[model samples]
Target chain A: MRCPETDNQELLVAYGAGRLGSRETAKLEAHLAECEACRVACAAQATVWKALDGWEAEPLASDFDARLLARIASEEQPGWRRRWREWLRAVAARPAVPAFAALFMVVAGFWLLPRGAPPEPRADAALVREIEIIEATLDDLEMVKELSGGDRGEGARSL
Target chain B: MKTGVQQTVVGVAALEHDAQLMLRVREGDQASFGLLLEKYRAPVVHFLYRMVQNQAVAEELAQEVFLRVYRSRTSYEPAARFTTWLFRIATHLALNWLRDGKHERLQERLDEEGEGQTVRRDVPDRRPSAEQILLKRVRRDEIRAAIAALPAKQRAAVLMHKYQEMDYAQIAGALGCSESAVKSLLFRAYETLRARLRRLA
Candidate 1:
């Protein structure tokens, strides 16, 4: 059949394979009614396919199962350590893993690391001075408290 | 591990046994995982061998495909046929491997020491003479190169259709597209192959 402009060689191949539905089949049949060249071409293609049916499938190679089974066995780990080892191997194989680990470390450092002492020497000195000033002020207040009311005598305090 | 008795797979027994093995795989049984590989290795390797045109690469990729299934075993749901899922994973890895360019494939091959095994495999030579074998190899190589040169989706569609005998619907699932898309992809693939291999005919 003379295929339409939209109907290209693929349809011809599909039609040759008997894959077209009834409507398409009817259209092809009607087209073939008028067109001899396409009909011949289709016949030739179909014949080639029929001839190909005599061709046997290539035999699968030996050791295919043994090798594949060995691979699958290696993946199914016997324990957590083996699984972790596999993960390390996989990560080492791909460049993406170390980058991901680095990013993970960065993110974890920002979020989870302990909030501890400031590191600057000036800040440390300031903190020590601040503690001393606060201590002096507390001493003055305690002296005032002693003068105002509470027991101050060493013997009474001890008792 | 099961000792001393790997069962031979045949007929409907082979098909039914695949599902049973898949069930064991889901429950973390290593022997069942081995059985799945034992049963499907040839067809799977053949499929990849045709797709990639490099027998050694195909063999390595075939192993990776099964290993992928084993690793994903915990998430394996028996909603569909195991072979279907297996092939879908195979198609996905192949296409993605292609898409990821040359870099992703470095690790998925035989080690440098085993590169000796990658020497050109001798296909069955039924041709008349050594010269005829050379000519046939040239022709087969050309056809394979043409098929591989096809756009990834179309090449995959052609492979699934030709070797796996998957209908359009199954291909749609495997390729993650609609059935009509599968049809269109296959149609395009066939057209490409016909154009490339026309001289060989």
Candidate 2:
């Protein structure tokens, strides 16, 4: 029989834990009888297991359940402010929300502008043409006044 | 018939019951959540206490574990045993706490409290002599120190293996590792413990 320590160490652990079946236990016992090293290893593991068994956990605090339930209740009924903040955070986490917001802003800007507002260059050209037209009209009025001024000049002189 | 198979069947049935309760919680059944909490609260606290070696921190972490369970109830699936999922949450929190190096200062406080609690708990019924109590305390301290000295993963593996009585597969599920890795961890951990505590036998 091979040494369990080398071939199958988990067997030693299971054996020490009393988890091995009767057949495997008998087999390991035979190996332990012939092998001093396996014997030492098994004994040591069993001792370690026993020492661990002595380390019992302390009793839980009596108010553990009460405290946990209270926390859960508080979580379930967070203040409106906190809920609002959480809602904002959840909204902020989604890529689509911000993207949609930006697109909406762009669309809104286009929609809110005056329908008849002209382009900047076209408005500048129109203003220049109006100024030229006013200048040309003023020249025509000056020419008419000159053409009628000689007779009026003579009449005023006579008066 | 194998005992392992029998235990697996039993474990599955128990987990199925827990899953049913959790499903009810998903549907807003507060009473079902309470039932699950009442059933698992002690084991979770005890496991965390053993892992962190501090009572206060263990209780705090246990609260977080349950809170997470409740918060995630909406997505609860019965793909795995509830114990596996619960312990996985627990083991993750404990490992994080240890990794953060928060346990160093608390260990001294634990030393002070742990001795008193152990003595008080033992004194009630058995009424062992003073010398015997002192001896037992010494042995218990040695065991705890030996376990604490192990690497965090190894410590978790050994605790689940020995105290929690979890088989390797369950431990692997909780630890998020393969069964072979868990076996290796236990092998190394037990080897270290035996070296430190062999004289106690």
Candidate 3:
């Protein structure tokens, strides 16, 4: 094995486990010839491989298959039927895009229906104009009172 | 009757004679689901118990996995090996349970308190006596403990390799990595196992 690195021992161990490619193995073999350490590494790796085969799985519990299948059976369903129904539901779910858009616009417009329009003149502006007219009338009355002061007795009776 | 179709049915039948009830669960069959529990209640419960190292959490999580399997029944495919799939699900749940960081190991010692106080024997002088069996069990336990000591990836690689007889490719799928990575995982796992088993050797 052409060893790629001193670290190739670990990789060689992996190689022995069938993990490494042939090129990697060839490289490791090349290293093994040149490096005594790698040979020892391969040997050390051999012991573990031997033990690994003897590591049997624990016995399955007596009822393992029974329960596992029961679960599968309970979960069984008609493959195509479910798919078909789902397909139909999907087809039924669609509405034309423009129809949907129109519906949405209608709902939005209903919510946004405008408030009552303001009059031509606002209430505050009308109030200010009325105040100006009243002030002019008060001035006019004051002028008339001054002019009529000489004839106050007869005018007062009429007034 | 010996036609391939007949054989297929027979195969599926033999597979389910014990757990046919579980088959019903996929069909939303509650009765079949109940029968499944009747058949597999112990194994499922104990498997989780061993997996999580906690009886209560195992029981709870086992129930959840079952519910999940039940919920996802419509997509169930029978083409694959059932035990592998089931254990895959179980393994995933157990791994998630371990996200809390090896609760099962700590709990195992606490639960077995006063039991392993002595230097347990794993191998005997070979006459195959009662002592030999006891020793064998102890050895197995030690090996198991060593296996448990490995990092999660190595432990899974080893367990899947050993217990599941999965090829490195299948392990790669379960591990969500490349086949080469799985090989490295197994190699590291073996290195650890060898070191631990050497004293017993």
Candidate 4:
């Protein structure tokens, strides 16, 4: 049988919870009497409420009040200090910002150095090559002087 | 003018009741605050425990509930029932905590503490044998898990309805939803519980 509005499970919940008005309850009761389907549904709803009656919350700890008071005391510190701590906590909780920041610092550190102290001007490859050539030419000139002086000294000794 | 006078009379009467204690609390009366704590601590803790499904977290949240109340005492308005206001704070906190999903390990604590826990003598029991006790506990645990498995709003609706015995209006007030919405939450919640727990029921 199709469930009527008055006898549906949802209305039965209200009826069970004493939420329905007297007129509504009377209508639901009348419908329940005629419809076995709604009756079973209502009974199931009752059982659900019955099963809920089985669970009980455990008692609070003995020092609950004391601890609560202590927490309040700790929270009652200077407003600026508390806000600062909260700010720090919020920043620490976000990983993406800090991770990006560290990466940026590392990249910027490499990018901002003074380019290895401007590459020492005298250390150029072309200048080193020119100095080596000059040294070779001077050594050739010294060799020529020594050979010519030896020939002149031999002539004088023969005379 | 008549409605205003009636409201003023009602407000006065409410002040004579719990609101008076809160007013004293606002005035820095520690004893009044203690009295209020003594009265509401258990119910609030129980509500929080059922909401979070964890004992330690429930107690912590309950403590936070009272702390929030104390902190906001200066602004406490007696326009609504004090319980309504209290549960409003509570439901807000519990919902936020659930949304955050801060501590999954706390659920382990709930299981450990709740398993085989003794049923209160207040529950009408015709059979008082060891087997009966074990059966009742197992059944209770199953039901607890079933209710906890509900969505946060549904669980809050059920807790307020079944445990706190709150009417639809009060549940709506605490949940900041319409009465029809509260009914819908409870309806869907019971439907799911009935499906999962039909055998126990």
Q: Candidate 4 chain A — worst ten consecutive residues by lDDT sum?
A: A1-10
Better of 2 and 4 by lDDT: 2
What digit string (tens of lDDT, one per residue) describes model 4 on residues A13-120?
A: 877666789998898888878888887787778788778776787977999988888767668879998788768768978999789889999999999975665655
- Point out where model 4 deviates above 4 Å: A5-10, A18-27, A73-159, B1-10, B14-16, B108-130
Best candidate according to TM-score: 2
Per-residue accuracy of model 4 over B53-142 as CA lDDT, tens digit each: 779888988888999999998987777778888999999999999988764566666669879996466655566887987898789889
User: Which DockQ value does candidate 1 get?
Assistant: 0.10
Which candidate do you rate higher for lDDT, 1 or 3? 1
TM-score of chain A of 1: 0.38
The true-versus-predicted C-alpha distance at residue B131 of model 3, in Å, is 5.1
The CAPRI category of model 1 is incorrect
Residue B17 C-alpha lDDT in model 1: 60
All candidates: TM-score: 0.57, 0.69, 0.45, 0.66
lDDT of 1 at B87: 82
lDDT tens string, model 3, B77-113? 6644445455567668778778777686766667698
> Which candidate, 1 or 3, has the higher DockQ?
1
True contacts kept of each: 0.17, 0.83, 0.15, 0.85
DockQ of 4: 0.45
> Cα miss at B151, model 4 (Å)?
0.8
Model 3 spans with C-alpha error above 4 angstroms: A1-39, A64-159, B1-71, B77-87, B101-127, B178-184
Summarize candidate 2's per-residue lDDT along B71-92 as a digit string, tens digits: 9999998777788899999999
All DockQ scores: 0.10, 0.54, 0.07, 0.45
